[model samples]
Target: MTPGARVAAAIEVLDDIEARRRPAADALKDWGLSHRFAGSKDRSAIGTLVFDALRRRASSAFIMGVETPRAIMLGAMRQVRGMSVDEIAALCTGQAHAPSTLTEAESERLASADLAGAPVHVAGDFPEWLEPSFIAVFGEAAVAEASALAARAPLDLRVNTLKGTRDKALASLAHLQPQPTPLSPLGLRLPLTSDGRGPALAAEPAYVKGLVEIQDEASQLAALLAAAKPGEQALDLCAGAGGKTLALAALMQNKGQIYATDSDGRRLMPIYARLERAGARNVQVRPQRRGGEGLSDLEGRCDLVLVDAPCTGTGAWRRNPDAKWRVRPGALDQRIADQDQALVEAARFVKPRGRILYVTCSVLREENEDRLAAFLAAHPEFKSLPARDMAEQAELPGLVAFASRFGEGLRLTPLTSETDGFFIAMLVRS
Candidate 1:
């Protein structure tokens, strides 16, 4: 399809999403199913435009002074794609499948598009309700932080040390020109195309052969911060799909026993195949069974417990921009409840002097610092560790500069770390 046709389709998809309040993926999939004539590339291009529109929806609407899907597409062309008015006009010639030619108002708006005096929420392209939480966490830098989160995220792959080194993986994917991530020793990053598409990793030998795994750089840093020692006993309390569990196995040189389990058995199903493909050893799966005693045998014997807790996922907005719009205050409350429960469960397995590495892909204080503070208050036997000391022990001393001012932990945001938003803290059982 032509780029103009793709833009038209993306506008329709966005309209469906807004009207039905459905997920963008669901709307996009349904659109693809109904319009079978669109090839894979056409569908991908349309999806990219739809996502980019969503990413800058607030600012786009503000600039165009309209919230309609057509205005969104035109404004996004100016703001996201950085197209000149003439450049955009070429695509909207009102011929064939192209979007109708922009009206005089739209052309003028595109030419004079500026967010000079817009509200922080509009300027940041995030929900207005989230502004207070962002301000609470970021102070005067809230707009900058949220704007960063509203941008596109690059693809990041973590080299599976159990199967290959970072250099080996880099060489294997050389055609993609992947670069080693600045923060993560094991991460290789591939920039997306201008239209926001990543390489098809399923066809890549490096990915298929288990030399690399798709993971955000911040997540890789979380696993590295755990710093699991060889021959230690560890438990991955919420090890959904075993991303970090496999990393722990490699870090332990496949010498330590790592028990991976999640509250939902369905989430744990993928880990088995991933473990086999990655050639991971010394890791056991404990899928929660219906009404069954769960991980009872793991009580009070773990040297390390990793809680990759659930949250609102605000930190991952760069990859899932629609999520930031759909999220509500109730979701944050529920996520905080879940995070608190996960910490309580993690504490049950840590032996004396053992540590619990609490991690979450959330920038909200209610999910990170507040939850940890409550956990520390309730569990007197556990104490928060200084971020500096933890970083030094993990051999990632550079992270101390990003230590949390709200409490004990390392805070990584797109603005601060150029990675996904992640909060990682360690609590030691005294």
Candidate 2:
């Protein structure tokens, strides 16, 4: 497909996403099925345009003074995709499958596309309601931080120490030239250019054998914050899909027991298989029928409790850029409520003097610092631990101030950590 056709396809997909109430990925899949004649390259080109537009949609629409799919696509081509009017015009020539020529209005808009940076309306790709929260959390660096969220993230893989060491796994994947992530010992940073294909690590023998798992370096760091040791009882209270649970199992060397439970049983099924593949024998999947009754025996019995609570997922926008467009301030508040419930419920299982790790894939204050403060207030017996001091205790290097806030939890942002945005707080039971 010609470049103009790709842009046209993206516009169509965006329109469906805006009106049909379908997800971006689903819309793209439907588009692909309907247009099977479009080759892989064409599909990829179209996908790139669609995602780029989604990443900067708010700003693109504001700059173009038009919210129609066509106007947004044209503005994105010039502002976000960095295309010139001439280049786009050539693609829209009278060729089969090519888009029609740019109208005079579009041409004029393209001519004035050179905004100094981002206009106030398009300052950040996030919703207008979140501008204050984002600015509060990120301060003067909010734009740069939000831009990082819009930027494409590298595929990160954590070598399962239970199956293989990072060095050995790195050696096996020499074809990819994966490099060590500065903070996490087991992490390998893959290239950022995705080639429109998902991360190829799944095809590697290491991945197939459960020697590696696709996890952000910051996530791995959050799991490490648990500091689970041999013969210790650890619990991943909100172990969705068991990514952190698996990491914890590897950290514990599959020893002792990890009571992996979530409010939803369906989310735990995949973890059972992954545990088997990783040869992890220590994870016990406990499906709770009710919110508070499940894991009654675990009350005050766990040495370490990890509440990997759900949140707005602001930190993960780099990977799922569409989330930035969908998330609103009210949604963020709902997430905070969810986190509070999950944290309160999970804290019940902490043994006397046991530690609980509260983690979120968000940089928002409510989800990070505010939650910790509320938890500490609710449970006066618990005290905050300095995240930097705790990280040092784990013998991890490459310390930064992002993780030094709140006197209890560590906050990891893309600007400082070069990884997904994550917040982790360790609380000890008095």
Q: What is the C-alpha RMSD of each candidate to the true structure, in Å?
A: 1.2, 2.1
Candidate 2: tens digits of C-alpha lDDT, residues 1-430 = 7666777788889999889766689999999999999998898778888888887787777767788887777777776657888987887765766677888877877877554576433666777777777878777888888877776678888999998898899988878878998889999987746433445566789888998888999999988878889899998888879999999999999889999888878888889788888888999988888645768998989999999888899899877877777776688778888988987887788888899888889888878889888878888988887766677767774454556444457778888778899888888888
| Candidate 2, position 368, lDDT | 85
Model 2: number of backbone collisions:
0
Q: Kindly provide the TM-score of model 2 when superposed on the true structure, using C-alpha atoms.
A: 0.93
CA lDDT, candidate 1, residue 381: 93
Q: Per-residue lDDT of 3-25 in model 1, one digit per residue for the tens?
A: 88888899999999999999999
Per-residue error (Å), model 1, residue 6: 0.9
- TM-score of model 1 (CA atoms): 0.98
lDDT score for residue 46 of model 1: 91
User: For model 1, where is the 10-residue window of minimal lDDT?
Assistant: 288-297
Off by over 4 Å in 2: 39-41, 116-121, 194-198, 404-407
C-alpha displacement of 209 in model 2, angstroms? 1.2
